[model samples]
Target: MLGKAWQFARRHKTKIAAVSAITGGLVLAGKLAESKFKQWQEEETRKMLEQIKKQHHYENTEKTSNETLKSLFPALIKTIEKSLDSEPILERIKNQTGNKIELWNELKVLSFARALAMIITGTQLVLLLKLQLNILSGILYIKQPSQVLSSRLQERFMALSQNFISFSVPKICEQIREKMIQLLALSLKEKFTITQLEAFFQTTLLQLDLPGFQKLIIAPDGDHISQPLNPDEHLLLDDLINNIVELLEHEDYAKIFRIGLQTSLSNVFDYLAESYLSHESYKENGLRSEVRLPVAKLIPILNQSITVYQSVLHALIKHYTIREYSANIYESFCQAPPDAIAKPSLSTLWPF
Candidate 1:
């Protein structure tokens, strides 16, 4: 009986343990499913509430918008009726504007009344200007050109010229010199090519109608022509014009041109010196020799180039009117001696 009980206990104990594990797993799965279903129901309830709230808000907005449009509809209809009625008003306004425009056209830019107004205005202006003359006469009286005021003005003019030479003219001269030199260099490079020079000589010396100067030999004027001449005479006559053209084309003539260019270029030194020496600053600085040396150096470069010579010559020469090197930097400024000297001397030069 004890052995049977032991065997029954062992077999039943294994079955009991397996049944308990299965029952526990089923209970856990049921609890998990219930929790998940509750969570899904709550989420669905929240989404449905959000959708209902949005729909309600959208319906309210649409109802308000419809009410506003209904409120404006009568005003819109009235505006349309008014616009439709304005066509005659528009036409009448256009006709009135056309009439006004014709009347305005008849009114000229100037007439008797305008001229009268202008005269009155000019007279008032002249009367107002008299105040300036009166004030000036009271302060700085000028009865005549020999008056103290006139003398003062003359002295001021001289001082102004001096100041310009001392301060302004140097810089102005530097700019002008730079511009002139640059223009000269460019003109030389462009205009004075050897090819152009040859063409110029050919045009000037060799007549286009008679390249061989046959007309000169034959005398187209029907005068001073020795007809039926000897062979030597014919040879001399025909050869004379050709000989001159040949001589002109000679290398010796080119050498002569170079020599002439050098001589003329050398004269430029005197010209520049004369111009520089005209300035009071040059005399004070004693830069005459300094100026001449540089000019002498520059003249030789011209000898090496006929282009340089012609360009400089072109810049120097004038037609109809003559030009002199006169600077007017102080034209607008009246520089009394005291005013010129009173200004800070260091103001002329600012160091960076």
Candidate 2:
């Protein structure tokens, strides 16, 4: 429906453009008028508020003595023992502010915010919670310190940790990918338009063994791929595999893979967590000690990595003559211009 309307407007672009301009002008005028009206209303409201203040003789009330407040408010103040029947003198308060509604609105908002904060923080229940914690600690291990968590709790703890890590993998992967993309943006040109991708895809298609594949699709009775695709009566079938590949390439694979990873991990998370709990190491004694041995485990891995790296360096030096290359580089650097040194290399065309 919208497409047809757009087509119609496109056909009568001049008329449509004029209409749009007029409509936009009317909207702008309406907005300006509304703004002016709002200003006028605010001015009228201010004037009305002033008129109300004047009519109520609030200026006279402002001259009330401190002695009068001490006498009147003190009398009005209610004791806890005495059945309270004291109310604020609304007129006196209203006279002082000359804005009853505004004062009440401010008070209501402030009270609500204070109450919300109190509830959120559990300020009133802190003492109760402290007592509960003390009792639980006593019950759990008043004598034993290290046995604060039981075997059951250890299981729960492991399970909780496994679940947390397993579930968090998607988010972790997402952040890693995001950071990778940020780094990639520095080097990789973000030019992934469909036209460019399709051209690339077609070029890749030309390189494939499509003719060999087409031979298999031929009818067994008599037909062999003479034109590679021109079948009986020249009823040439379009290359289905190429069509499929084209269709696949045209899809948002990045989006598809991201969604698939998230969905796949959602199911995998539970399986991974279950497997972690069932692992023999976790079932054995001293779960806490094992969990704490990350640094010990990491040290060996680090040492292995260092050894591998050192060995790789040795191999590269032996095989690639990297040291010789470095010496050649140093000599070239020493001979070249100090500020703008040129790199010297063996010219492949004239190495001798």
Cα lDDT listed for each candidate: 0.32, 0.30
**Candidate that would win on lDDT:** 1
> On a 0 to 100 scale, what is the lDDT of residue 205 in model 1?
26
In TM-score terms, candidate 2 sits at 0.16
lDDT string for model 1 (209-276, tens) is 21121112111222222234445434433433233334334443233333333333343333434544
Against the true structure, whose TM-score is highest? 1
Clashing pairs for model 1 are none
TM-score of each: 0.23, 0.16
lDDT of 1: 0.32
1-352: candidate 2 lDDT, tens digit per residue: 9999989988999988899999999999999999999999999999898656543432232222122223322221111101111123234344675565444433322222221211111111121122122222222222242333334332332232222222322233233233322322211123322233234323433443323322222112222112232142122112212222232232232223223223322332232233334545657853522322222222222112211222222232232232232233233323333322123222311111
lDDT of residue 13 for candidate 1: 93
| RMSD for each of the candidates | 44.8, 41.8
